[model samples]
Target: MTVIVGASAAGLACAEALRRKGYTGPLTLVGAESHLPYDRPPLSKQVLSGDWEPARARLRSAEALSALDATLVLGDPAVHLDVPERAVHTASGRILKADNIVLATGLRPLTLAGQPTLRTVDDALTLRKRLLGCTNAVVVGDGVLGAEIAATARRMGVAVTLAGPQSAPMALQLGPRVASELASLHAAQGVSLRLGAAVTEVSEDGVLLETGEVLPADVVVVAFGSAPATDWLQDSGLTLGNGIVCDSRLRAAEGIYACGDVARWHHETLGRMVRLENRTNATEQGIAVAANILGADEAFLPVPYFWTDQFSAKIHVHGFVSPDATVVEGSASEGRFVVRYHRDGAVTGVLGWNMPKQARQHRAEISLRCPAGVAASTPGAA
Candidate 1:
């Protein structure tokens, strides 16, 4: 028997992969939320913007999940883990014991009081309802989620103010040049930029900044970042820090493994332990963990990739971005281009602004270069 915790993208992927790889053992998937596993990327864009229904974001239909032949335990949050017995204790007083266990609990959003944070489909729907009634919104954090929320709100005809410590949105992930261009795009799209300041507090009126300025808004969104959901494993005898510490195989202990946003495993190529809290990594890492569980004994090394759509811009990135970048193809001035980032005379990243195809074609170069800095994606709210 195998028990998978999370029922998220990663957990669903792992369960499907296990079955695809010919595992016929009894399987169970547990989720904290009552809703079925859904794709999170759309929560901030399509779902929130009313372009896509919440049900459309579901990863699989009821019939498809039924075909997998796995028992699903929903709305029962795991409270504790007994490592020795390989058992999971849930909030609903159900104790599931399994021979193999996969931890895919994902993340917990960092939020401020009286603010909405997008993580689940329900959260997206709730925020969407508020957005409809709001005339002004202030989004805290300049990361991927924050930028996305601000863009969505602005498109809905609500005035948006984006506040963060970075000089430009996604500066930490996209580096300086591309991020600055992104700033220009946001400003042109009618989303006010309040960069280079930390959000000191959140009130009924608006968000207070460290610079003693208050950005007034009717709706506030906190999308700064997230931490791994490993609180249930603290006393479970598993090594926990940034996430569940795992080896190259993602094994937390004997008969147990961790994957997705909650797992921080050693990267063979980078020669360092890393944790990525992004949608792509969650699915890919889950598949990789499934392979390792079946005795593939392979090291999981992947070129991180992520895409963001705001207004007329669709940015696709492969690998890590550095400030020093050279336009390899297209033209940045025309808002359509592919740029290669360099660090210490080697290529570290590739980005495409409205040219996804060209950017993907250059993805091969990342493997050839294979610098110490693997293009780990910037963590999202999920």
Candidate 2:
């Protein structure tokens, strides 16, 4: 059997791709969650805001999952992988023997010392339940997820405050200027902003900031990014870094491969080991890794893409851009603009703040330029 670990986007996509690649062997997918594969993006938006139920986050229906032709081991995670024995041991003590293994365990949220955190469906629903008749909410990160949660909480009639140690919200991802505009939009939507201060501790009432300000909140959420869910592979003899260390082909070890947020593979185009935590990379890497699993040997070098939607704003990003080197290309005050980030002399990244058409145009151009310090080898669309 070809055993696939994880049941989210990466796992399910990999399973489907394996079928597409004509793998007719016994297939088994082990998932940590009890529920079937579901879309995670809505957890912070519609689901958290009570606009949609937890069931509405389903990525594929029961009928669709039944068509995948794979045995599913749900709600039980693989705790151990005996590399030499070629077997997996799950939490329920079920042993699975496999000829090949695909590691797509994805990421675990890096939350603060205290308060509730959001990553899975249960986390979102718990926060939603807590938000019922809640007057104040505090989100303990200024990144995309934190900002989204704060926005959702604010829209749900809860006064929200986003606290983090950045100059502006989502600065690391969208750069300071564009992130500043996004921060402004959040502020205009009645969400309080607490930038440039780290949360020291979480209390029953609120969080204590580094600068000694205590913001009282009825609902506190910690969204301090995430790390790889790779603890299960520590004893498996596979290399582990920020994520499961993989080659350019997404191969971690002999007969073992990885993809999605959990796979930190060396990106040939970027000339670095990049672990992207976005839907684009997860799905793209799944497709690419499936081909590699079928002996394609194609290098996974992608012009990274991610999108974020927050209160009347939609941001689309393409390519690699440092937060400190970003500059606005058009009128950011007008709300619909593109933020162009340069690497050396060439444009290496583009961010579209409601400028989707123009941003799509620059992707082909941006992919051609090598990253700031890397030497150019393959040209555009490689």
Candidate 3:
């Protein structure tokens, strides 16, 4: 028997991959949420903008999932993991025994008290309703999630005020130059920028800044960040840091594995362990974990990649970058640029804004670990 926990993208992908890999074992998928596995990326963009209905976010149709021959135990959160007995106890006091277990429990949105944070379907629906009725919105935290919300709000004809602790939007992720360009882009769209500011309080009407200024807002959206949903695994005796620590094979402990946002797996390419909360990572890691469980001697060493759509711009990133890394090419002014992070004359990461083809090509080249010195030769090589 194979039991999978958390029926989100990672878990569902794992189950489907197992079937595709010809695993004919008894499969049981447990999910805390009642809804089926859905694509979350669209929730912040299309669903929030009313361009895509919430029901359309389902990654697998109910019939499709049923065809996979997996029993889905929805709306029941796992309460305990009995490692010695190789069984999981749910909130309803149901004990499920399995030969192998995969923990695909994803992350939960980090929220500030008195502020709205988007993560689940309900949260997105509530936010969409508020945004549709509001004329002005104040967005705190200028990360990808925050930027998406602000962009969608502006498109809905709502005045937007984007605030962040960095000097500009996405400064922590994209660096100062790109962040400045993003700020300019938002400004050109009539979105107000409150850079280098911290929110002291979140009120019903607006946000109170540390500078003793209050900004009136019809809606306040908080997209500060997310943390892995590993609180239930505290007694499972698995290594836990920022997330569940797994080895290069995505194995947490004996006969137990983890993937997706909850798994902090080691990346042989970067010589470090990373916990990426992106759909690509989740899907790839899910397949990798499934292979390892089925007795395949494969090491999951994938080049990290992620993408976000904000207004009219589509930003894609590949590889892990560091603060000290240099951007070898491309500029943010043209909106279509590739920023390369180089370490010792080798490309370590690539950030592409509004360059999908280049981003995809870069990701493919990077995943193959192409010749160490050949990254600089690619088109849009940054």
Candidate 4:
């Protein structure tokens, strides 16, 4: 018997993979939320923009999940994990014993002391309602989520003001040069960019900056970041540092595995541990964990990749680029370039803004261990 702790991308994919790999064991999935497993990446985009309803985001219908022969215990949180007995205790006082367990609890958005965040479907719906009625929105944090919200607000004809400590938008991920260009793009779209600023307080009507300036707003959104949803596993004896620590196989403990944004798995290629909060990593890692759990001798080695759609631009990232890495290809001004991060003549990572085909090729070539020279091509020309 196998018990999955989450019903999101990682948990759902893990269950499907187990069935596909011929695991005829009794499978049970436990989810805290009432809604079925749904695609979260679009919650901040399409769902927030009213283009798609929450029901349409589900990856599997109730009937489809039933066809997989997996019992779903929804609307109840997994409150306890008895590692010695191999059982999970739920909020509803149900003790589910399993031969193996997969923890795919995913993550919760980091909310400010009082401000709201856009993480779950309910959060998006609330935000959408507020955004539709509000005239000005004050967004805290300049990361991907913050930027996306700001972009969407501007598209809806709402005035947006982005406040963050980063020198430019997404600076922590895309480096200063590319982040500067993104900041300029946002500014050109009529969104106010308050870089290098911190929010001292979030009020009912506005955000008070550290500089003692109160920015009037109808809604305040906090998009700072997220931490792993591993608080419930603190006493589970799992090797948890920033998240539930897992090996390359995504196994955190004996008969128990973790993946998605909640697992800090070791990357063999990078020779270090990385916890990626992206859909690609989540699905691939989930499948890999399932294969290994089913006694397949497959090793999970995936190139870290992510994509973001902001306004009219779609940015793709392959590999992790350091700040000091040479800007191998592409210019920041054009907003369509490939930035490669290298160390000692070997390609380590790549970031492609507004370049999908190049990013896809980069991910494929790097996964196959392509030569450095060949992988370092200009955007769109690859």
Best TM-score among the predictions, by candidate number: 1
**Backbone atom clashes (below 3 Å) for every candidate:** 2, 0, 1, 0
State model 2's lDDT. 0.82
CA lDDT of each prediction against the hidden true structure = 0.88, 0.82, 0.80, 0.80
**Which regions of candidate 1 are displaced past 4 Å?**
367-382
For residues 225-279, write the lDDT of model 1, one tens digit per residue: 8899998888999999889999888999998999898998887777777788688
lDDT of 4 by residue, 265-364 (tens): 7766655666777888778878988998988756577766777888767887776554545554566666677766665555667777777777666654
lDDT of 3 by residue, 1-382 (tens): 9999989899988999999999999999999999988988998888888898889999988889889999999999998998877899999999999989999988877788767888888788999999888878999988878888888889888899998787887765665656677888899998998878788898775789899888898889999777888899899888888888888899988889998888887767645666777788789888998999999957787766777787667877777443444444455656687776655555666777887777666654343343232122111111
Error of 3 at 170 (Å): 1.6
Q: Is candidate 1 or candidate 3 better by TM-score?
A: 1
Q: TM-score for candidate 3, please give it.
A: 0.91
**Cα-based TM-score, every candidate:** 0.97, 0.94, 0.91, 0.92
- RMSD, one per candidate, in order: 1.9, 3.6, 4.5, 4.6
* Model 2 per-residue lDDT tens digits across residues 17-39: 98998988888999999998998
Q: What is the lDDT of residue 182 in candidate 2?
A: 87
Clashes of 1: 2
Which parts of model 2 are misplaced by more than 4 Å? 323-330, 372-382
Candidate 4 clash total? Answer: 0
Candidate maximizing lDDT: 1
